[model samples]
Target chain A: MQNPAAPAWTADHFFAGARACIPVAISVAAYGVVWGVLAKQAGLSLLEVMLMSGLVFAGSAQFVALDLWTATPSTLPIGPIILATLIVNLRYLLLTATMRPLVRPGTEKRSAAAMWLLSDENWAMTVGEMAKGRGSIAFLVGGGTTVWCFWMVATVFGRLIGSAIDDPTKYGLDFAFTATFLALLLGMWKGKADLLPWLVAALVAIISAKLIPGSWYILTGGIAGSFAGAIAERRRGYAHQS
Target chain B: MLTSPEALLAIAGMLAVTVAIKASGLLLANRLPQTGFIAAWLRHIPGAVLASLVAPAVVTGGTAEILAAAATALVFVVARNLFAAMATGVIMVFLLRMALGG
Candidate 1:
């Protein structure tokens, strides 16, 4: 019952506008599989993985938590655990803000609710498409739903194959995050002025890691960068693309 | 290691903090002009936010992570293709494992 000839404005638009997301989805699913495999291999119970995936509904944080727990099984990483998850998922705030204008005003609450259901792939698709001024609610449903179901399935599947994912050196999975990030950064860096604040933040984040824990660097660095970027935008009287 | 009670507490706490952080932007987005201080900040948000996410993942990594990241950066810079860079990165890691007998 699929409409094959629809314009690129709907969720189907992503199929036409960008084929890259397909690989992105595969990377995410593979990571999910890695998470699934690691959960059991780390000696944690399956209930832990299922519950974490179901409730936490986060990918990077879950992987980080599993790694921490595996490395040190003596103590629970609940505090740092929660903080890490929060920090990694904090980008969603930005994603939702981008959608505010396009969202139906009457459905603000519903749209906000739907934001929680978002993930990296769909978020990228939504914001990227919207930036081009080709926004639609259908895009959200099509792309968001696709990401959501794929994630749940990927997590469940990842756990099943958790044992086989032990070779960290082999999967090249870490770079998947890196490349996606770089691509995103380049996509955003449309001008010369965007360079300075980012360099400052990178320097600060690395320096902060030396002073604080692994995760605090990200939190502090992000706040510092956002504040720095905001202030710079104010002073320069520069018009932002947002 | 947390029981159901502990897990509930952890999740609830996470939800509370996340909601609090997001609320400020949500509220400000409603109040501010479509193109003003808030909007400008928002405009810069995507690039800045993405930079923050990728920086740590790339440079602050271990041996395997770094090696793979290098390949990713190389591909992204040259190819300028998102999928190709990511795939090359993932493939590099898998190949590294195979070559190293890991």
Candidate 2:
């Protein structure tokens, strides 16, 4: 069946996207604050906090950066920090790769600007709308702008007040990262087809995380699991053909 | 306050690579085959990456962590709300750790 007329790339759709993302923006702000607090504890100066959050603009990567941060700049492991960020943010390649349908043809530059602001939350929201046959690039930009604003503000606020919270572990705040990521993984559940990939990824990650002393497990597991998924699908396809 | 060269370089490197990754996806989307093995693999990357991210932490975090992960998944599945599920997991881990004499 032909898709209905695509939504117009107008200000109205933009604002509608922003309004729809209010709840998600709230959650993003919450995580942003957590990251900010952790950044402060990790010996990041206020200026550093602003630059990292403003430029990097990725939650997981920022968090991992903190884990690799050193108190003294002279001894900082710059190479490892950058490498970890690359690995953590590599998932965006997949997230943003599926954006062809959202942007209009011949507008790659503008779409690149929009993609820069794309967070997991807004991307999911925009894609969800696409699945319903009622989304546009404006909607995505609107939602992404909202999330970006909240993240910048909340993270700065957390850094300013970081001194107040000396011990995050006392309140079990450390577990927040695991919990958030767990929920995200659960939210991605499609069906039985996902079982093989997820299992392989998890098992490989568990073993690699122990053997190697870095964030390489994420890269390795992601590659291994995705290949496993593709191979499984190929086999199923062959079975059907036969 | 002035930022160090190391910090600036690190952030710049991160910014460069991240932008490249995000932009490459959109720029290459047109060239990528929509239906094929590559597409199927791309479809699975998000879940696999997430699983890889969360698994080690959950597996090695001890009893409190393991239980909290379960609560996290259950709350997420039921409420379909990310914030609520995360809160439930945090609270469960907190209480469990205390009760078990953390």
Chain B TM, per prediction: 0.51, 0.85
- Tens digits of lDDT, candidate 1, B1-102: 433555555555555555544443444455545655666655554455456666776666656666777787788778777667767777876777566665
Task: Give DockQ: model 1.
Answer: 0.34
> In model 2, which runs have C-alpha deviations exceeding 4 angstroms?
A1-10, A74-77, A128-134
Candidate 2 lDDT over B1-102, as tens digits, reads 457889889899889888888888877766766768988887887778788888999998889999999999999999998888888888999999998886
True contacts kept of 2: 0.74
Q: Score the docking of each candidate (DockQ).
A: 0.34, 0.62
Q: Report the alpha-carbon TM-score of model 1 versus the true structure.
A: 0.69
Best by TM-score: 2
Where does model 1 exceed 4 Å of error? Answer: A1-27, A34-45, A58-74, A101-106, A123-139, A170-184, A238-242, B1-8, B12-28, B32-67, B77-83, B93-102
In terms of lDDT, the poorest run of 10 residues in model 2 chain A is: A1-10
- Which is the leading candidate under DockQ? 2
Q: Encode model 1's per-residue lDDT on A115-153: one tens digit a residue.
A: 554566766776777677664545665665555556668
Which residue pairs overlap in candidate 2's backbone? none
